[model samples]
Target chain A: GIQVEQSPPDLILQEGANSTLRCNFSDSVNNLQWFHQNPWGQLINLFYIPSGTKQNGRLSATTVATERYSLLYISSSQTTDSGVYFCAVAVYYGQNFVFGPGTRLSVLP
Target chain B: IAGITQAPTSQILAAGRRMTLRCTQDMRHNAMYWYRQDLGLGLRLIHYSNTAGTTGKGEVPDGYSVSRANTDDFPLTLASAVPSQTSVYFCASSGTASSGYTFGSGTRLTVV
Candidate 1:
């Protein structure tokens, strides 16, 4: 079983501010993903990065598989971004995906 | 296009009652999964099916059961619900295990 830990369990940011959320896993993973659980509880996929960097709109994510950690960057945050961001990982030999506690972000206007 | 749809957005059931959570996907994905999310706790996998007719237990499958009789539907059953089973259940599907999963809106189940 792999342990996934997310940093800054809770975050409050002013609209237009930038923030970085981190996820560290106990072991190497074959799959890593960042998801946003919206106010309606819909899990939307943000990024699927096992390694390397990717960007979509104001969001970007970087994963260092060697270091066993990943980072998600949200720039110019908006009020609609107020929700929980989760990181999930699937280890090499594991059939189940494990998720981090999540980073609860509250973007205040 | 209904990527994935879960039946009964919310449910209230008495303890010891049997309930089934239905999930269906129109994408024709080969894999489907069931997970439970608790407050402050991350989603925990309950069961998954690689394809039709093949199912496997996940992290928390003791109190739950699932069947995948066909590619489009995967249903989870709680034989005897308990208070501890109160949580939000999410159903997801993927083309492959390494790909990103498409999740449903989720079903909020409460056992009293």
Candidate 2:
């Protein structure tokens, strides 16, 4: 089983601010994804970056597989981005995925 | 299109009672998963099915059981509910083992 650790357990930002969150895994992984759990508790898929980098809207993520770490960037944050962001990973030969503790973000309008 | 729907958004059950959380997906995905979210600990896998008729235990499956009789349905059952089992449950489905998964809205259960 792999262990995923997320940094900055809690974060608060003003509207239009930017922030970055990091995730570190204990072992190699074949699949990695970033999810945003909205206030209503719906887990929205933000990125599926096993490696390299990807961007969508004001969010972007980078996974350095070799370093066993990943980063998620939120630029020009909005009130809508206020929620818990999670990073999950699935090992190459693992049957289940592991998730980090998550970073709770609050955006003040 | 009803990508995924979970039955009984919330439930309050007495300890030692039996309960089942139903999850169904219309996408006909081959892989289905069950996860539980607890305060501070993050989401932990309960069980998963690679396809119909095949099941596997996950990180925390001692008090939970799941079955995938068909491609579209995967239900998790708690044989004897306990207060420790109280948490938010989420069901997810994916087309393949290496693809993004679509998760249900989640089920909040309380065993008192």
Candidate 3:
């Protein structure tokens, strides 16, 4: 089983501030995804980056597969962004998708 | 278009009762997975099906069972529910492992 660890277990940011969340895995992964679990508990897909960098709106993610870690950047954060961000990875031909604990972000208005 | 539909948005069941959570996807993906989410613990996989007719256990599969009779439907069953089984269950599907997953709204289950 691959071990996944997410840094900055909890974060509090003022609206309009920028923050970076990190995820590190123990082994090579075939898939890496960033998800936002809103206050209502819906898992919203953010980015699917196996490797390389991708940007969606004010949010972007970069995964360095060789280093076995991924970074998620949130710029100009808003109150709506207050939620838990999770990083999940699928290793070994996607046999299983393991999830990290999560980075709980609270964007204060 | 409903990407994924989960029945009974929320449920409350007596301990030891049997319940089945229904999940249906219209995208016709080859892989389907069932996961349960708890406070502070994040999401934990319960079971997964690579394709129709094939099922495998996940991190927490005890007391939980899943069946994929076809590509569109994957139902999770609990033989005997317990208080600890109370959590929000999500169903997801993906065309391929690298393509990421589309998740259902989720079913919030409470066992008393």
Interface RMSD for every prediction, one decimal?
Answer: 1.9, 1.7, 1.2
**lDDT by residue for model 1 over A1-107, one digit each (tens)?**
89999999999999999999999999999899999998889999999899999999999999999999999999999999999999999886335678999999999
Order by TM-score, highest first: 3, 1, 2
Colliding residue pairs in candidate 1: none
After superposition, the stretches of candidate 2 with alpha carbons farther than 4 Å from their true spots are none
lDDT of 2: 0.92
Q: Model 3 over residues B4-108: C-alpha lDDT tens digits?
A: 999889999999999999999999899999999988788899999999999999989999999999999999999999999999999999988678988999999
Candidate 2 chain B TM?
A: 0.97
Q: For model 1, how big is the CA root-mean-square deviation? A: 1.2
lDDT of 1 by residue, B21-106 (tens): 99999999999999999986689999999889999988889999999999999999999999999999999998877777889999
Model 3 chain A: weakest 10-residue lDDT segment is: A89-98
Q: Write the per-residue lDDT of candidate 2 for residues A1-109, one digit (tens) a residue.
A: 6888998999999999999999999998889989999989999989989999999989999999989999999999999999999998988733466889999999999
* Residue runs of model 3 more than 4 Å from their true location after superposition: none
Alpha-carbon deviation at A81 in model 3, angstroms? 0.8
Better of 1 and 2 by TM-score: 1
Question: What's the lDDT for all of these models?
Answer: 0.93, 0.92, 0.94
DockQ of each: 0.69, 0.68, 0.77
